[model samples]
Target: MKFNESLFDNEQTRKEFLQTTSALLISLSALSLLHCSEEAPQKPSKNLNWITTKPEKRPVMNVAYSPTRILLKNGIIIDGSGKPPFTGDVMINGSTIEIITPKQINFKGTTIDCTDKIIAPGFIDAHSHLDWILPLDGHPELKNPFMEQGITTTVTGNCGYGVAGFMPKSKYLAFIKNIGKGFFSGDSSTQKDKFVQKLAVSLTSMQQYLSYCRQHGIPMNMANLAGHGTTRMSLRGYESKPLDKDEMKTMLYHLEQAMDEGAYGVSFGLQYEPGIFATNDEIAEIAKLVKKKDKIVTCHMKAYSALSGTYPLKPFGTPHNIIAINEMIDIAKQTDIRLQLSHLIFVGTKTWKTCPQALSIIDKAIDSGLDVQFDTYAYHCGTSVINVFFPSSFLAQTPQIYEDKVALLKLRAQLELIVALLGFGYNDIQIINANNPELAKFNGK
Candidate 1:
């Protein structure tokens, strides 16, 4: 059986097709950085031409301005208002939806006959890392996966980390090269220094990262949240402890600075360090800062299984998944800060039964006036560093745990439990991205 090739003729249909299928073709991180920085290496001739045909006063992100209009006519519209699908015309004035009507629109500078097409509000990738691709100096592309799927905007700084505008010189360059090209191995060793020195300019602060795009141009509108992992790592470097009084003060100061610089909110990677090191009390204190600023806090919880936990210990207690959910809810209740739950995955086959209970918890919280919401993946699996699979407490041992006889026995028990919880064996896992070039051969194997 074959799909009709002509489905590509419709712009909207084609966008959806490209968005869903691109991953089958290449790694997901193949996002294109289309900024027109004259310094893009290897090819000095390409550029990104931006249009400000309709600009607004104090435009979001301070992007360039101009007055413009577009009318999408005769389309099936899902207005996102809980109404049934209807045939209508949608008008846009710059980035705003100027009007929507059942009849033909009037005074359109650009009109598209979206006949037999699905016209809806632009989808937002609420958990995204598009900002990470923005600073990449080379290996640019014409479009990103989100944009191809008709996504107009994306939120980045997810899973408790993001590329900040104010990254230190070494961290900034290290991040760029690591994400762009996998780190240089034996054969590629000579290329590392060359890559970093050639592109020495690192984004300096939240303000600078945004301004860089405003000046260079970005295809989709983006909002970044300050990463709790990054902020804590900057001061503490994964020591497995909460911030002290003065350290907490410094953390608050940095958060305020980021908020003033245009961060949409803050996010936590509770499963990942140094997020795992943070206590509920510590997290609540940080949330209060967000509350004062009227911003949000998005958290990737400590565990995803109903009974599975890092340990039968503090920070991550038994029934870890439920404990993680309650932690965020508790923060919302205490600080009154808007809370966003990331992914909300239930790992391990046995844990899925707890879904109703999990949702019930969130439902009770929202019904009681606590501002809470969540997002999840369309599919079951995800990509991450292989080490993310283990408990942080176990991983934080002085000498890494792989070789010791007793440690290995203990680790085997942990692995056996993890395997039992998933029900699916190891075959389900696939390697997509690897930092070590030697391991690159195993990708997609």
Candidate 2:
């Protein structure tokens, strides 16, 4: 889930998720709007990157406007300054704010009585997967759940996985959208769906995809990141190998081209395929490219647990979560690029106490002049792709394990240990959307 408008507009939701979101310095949250207010307080050193920046002066575009524009009246204006809220009236001329004043302005146009309601800037979902709609030839549902939540802008192509790398199949879209057992319809016995029938979906390049989407119109404003996983997959499909000289050159060319085509930056899904296999050196090279472009880097770390991750599969002196933190920090330090850690969570039960240590590492890095920050989910519980909790080798050898009774028992034993380590049993993990029909009966059980 992305940070929607509810993070700012909806009081209960905000308080439910975060008692104080003061640490979201680098995020696209309305917290950035604090610096935009003339009455806003000075930016603190901890949030150094939140310094106010005045855009280059440019004339407003001369577009024809409707005579009667909507106006909001008698609303409590929350300027997002972390200051006290004030009562005010806001006048609008189309999407442009004509005025925001405490004193009443007598207007004859359509007026919306926002009495006792909050009038804040439109929210930005910095970690959105709206890029999931990339495969649709046309007709994007304008009234989707995001819009219902008052989110006007979204940062798409997050988690470094999307249609960016491959032509999305109906099953893939279904899986991402949580569309029931249809996503796992790999067998002939499954019901045939029109959605499953392949359609002509081209435009693999960043510019082409973006241009196509614009031509079709969108529900909200979006800034997309080129998926590092997708980029690797495009070049080498699921090949868990290091990049050679030629391949490195090609990858650079592809990434640079995406930036040039207006991708916001690069995102790394270190826990996911192609990205999981990515060597530190390879990641460094990509980060360096982002540094050259002066764009941001977002990463989903390799592991969030005490004893699991890509680094040596397990660490000796340090925990896997700490190693993951250092990995991103070191990348930022080396490349001097702005880095954002996506959904920083202590995965297993044993690692729950590692919170302070993780924050300490990040705090020290930021104190030392590194541009680093992170975001987290509201609750302690989470869900993940099955591969996350199991060894990749175990997943790869699934058929073999099933065939050997001893191996199957061993696998079950390992799962039990992992479950206990996670501080929850299999029962705690609710099946929101099971992929396979054979598993549909287990949903919500």
Candidate 3:
């Protein structure tokens, strides 16, 4: 239709506005498509890819002490001797329990009023894996968590992990580098050298870590047990085989060296990989060495179930699954070697009503003057690596055989969730490495 010049100008303005709106709409649609493509799901496959970012760095605090020595006044002391607690003042010099007294003494140290507090030797974690998980530099949480629980010393290298000697020199160097950078600040070069030397010696045993404590003034003291699984893996690859004559000689030599190095004893995890491959004879040979050294032999026994259905072999009645415990008892009887069973409940729980009977067997052994003891955690749920869920028995009797993988998956998820809630990740969960430098390097990080 014919229109005036003013109408034409207005029509042009409206046309321009509509064109701009249309362009914007097209741009928005394209952006949405791009976003969707980035988030598109992958094809159904066996592998699931998940990416987690590193946790934020915690704040560093400048902790200053007026005097490096701390004196506790009028505290009840329980010295871990299984003795009665008594009132006393304790003096700590560096990390050692220097002095304890019923009456106050004139000392040039900073005094703390622990008038009513119960003082005891810091709780000793008989079994721990701190070498991997707890950073060398020590986090406030790491230090505080144990300190709050009254733990001053922790025993690591349990279940075939944290064996420093099993690692290569290069790997050990990297471990020292990480720990030095993270845990200590001044004169680390010397500290690193000393730590490396200790590992080198400890390969034969944990005596080096112990010696290092006595030699260079340690902040905390530790004791360790030689891992039978680690030794077997070192001698033979992950294959199941008996040791050859020369291999046996070498293994014995190393075992002797470790004993001489002051290892508290040898720990065997019969349920774990290479350890599962070991024969009773091989274990007895090692147990003999432990006895000769007058050291304890601790074992994570094979089976934790009493149900005949749970047995790997039917009608054997030889208790193939509980063979490790039976073997240990036999060894103790024969060699008179002291033995400690780790986590007595899991294995004893399955029989339900027969729990007392199982315990009685241990008690009878103790009464017969056999050097045997057992330890247990105060909780029902246990945390172990996901790989531990895999079946290793010949019968393939494991959770994997069950159609419902839900229980296993739920257990893993619960552990991860708890760890995350505690402000940690898998990386924070230490992996034990003996010969792997790449793995050892993570300890410092």
Candidate 4:
């Protein structure tokens, strides 16, 4: 056909136009695909990639091996006994404290002159969950942060999340298998099945991790608490059900085993799943076991609010937060077991003002000769697995309105900072396992 000059383009020009048109079409198609993909529902990955291929090994860092001994000159020592601070020169040989003298000691090793600084036996975090939530490889840095905060020793894996070495192999395998299934399943039934499977696996895995720690010299000394929720989940499925006599027996046996394995005590996160389902009688039974072993019973009490109506049970009634605390108190009173009420501030809600009242009760119990100790964190608001938001009380009652403005503001700022830094918007940033290489890799960048 006799075409216009414009239509009768050269072969090269025609090819170029065709290529450009194709490229434009492909780009448009890709944009559409991207939009659709964004809108599409997410499916569980068939292949669970939670376990990273490259296992995390400790990074190489500078370690100073002293030729002889080190002397810390003119330092104030707080011996962690809540005693008076003393000023003196302390000499250290290897890991042992050699001597504390008013006069300086001649030593060949490194000398840290802490004239103005407070020299204390590292700070002890009596109750912390650093083991699970903290990045494994970042442990050194994480530990440094704690050290910077003057915390030398941290009691991790509390609230039924025992440390690595405490869990057994059979339980570990079961937990892994169950978690694997959960990673693939979608239906409620599958989820239920996976939950049961995972509970068993977790219990066994915890045992294995504990054993591993024993085999290798533990980097830092850790005291564990047998998680009541994990034990109950292992015995009973994820569905809320009463534990049978046999299951209770199994639970007690596991608790005893954990105690034998050098666990400090038993802990319960009664506010969380599985724990919420646990009855007072069930907890009492566990308390009895702990008492028999002369160990402590630490509980994360359910509700800590003035809105008593929110909880179906009345204040201090059955299943009430106060009731749970009282139950542990009763156990201590009856059996004389040490009882530690964990994180009083976070759970206290607006009752922060009323914490003194609660403490008074504990102090009274102590005065009456019942062993009881309670802990409060430096920060007012607390962080947990469920959510990252500040305590409802903090949001509900502003410092301008509340009587405790300074405390509330300090807590609020800390919570805000943590939320901002951690990108609390990202839901997937959960700390699953200690050996979770994905999080531990790249210096936790």
- Local distance difference test scores for all models: 0.63, 0.62, 0.53, 0.52
TM-score of every candidate relative to the true structure = 0.74, 0.73, 0.58, 0.61
> Which model, 1 or 4, shows the larger TM-score?
1
What is the alpha-carbon lDDT of model 2 when measured against the actual structure?
Answer: 0.62
Q: Measured by TM-score, how close is model 1 to the native structure? A: 0.74
Order by lDDT, highest first: 1, 2, 3, 4
Point to the candidate with the largest lDDT.
1
**Candidate 1, superposed: residue stretches over 4 Å from native:** 1-71, 91-99, 105-111, 137-143, 165-204, 307-309, 313-318, 398-403
Q: Of 1 and 2, which scores higher on lDDT?
A: 1
Report the Cα lDDT for candidate 1.
0.63
**Tens digit of lDDT per residue, candidate 4, span 89-169?**
677877898776544455556888886555677667788765432323233543566667776556765665443322244
Cα deviation at 141, candidate 2, in Å, is 8.2
Give the per-residue lDDT of model 1 (tens digit) for 1-445.
2223432333334334333222222232211111113453575432312211111211121112224877776676777787766666777777798777665555526778876577888888898766655443442352466677888888888877755523355343444434333222222433443223333244545776677768767677888898877766656566776678987887777767888899998989887767777888888988999999999999988877644435452323346678789878988999999999998776655566668889999999999999999998665566544445556766566334333446544644665565555443244445564433444565564
lDDT for residue 45 in candidate 3, whole number 0-100: 50
| Number of clashing pairs per prediction, in order | 10, 0, 7, 22
Q: In angstroms, how far off is 42's CA in candidate 4?
A: 49
What is candidate 2's CA lDDT for residue 169? 34
- Which prediction has more favorable TM-score, 1 or 3? 1
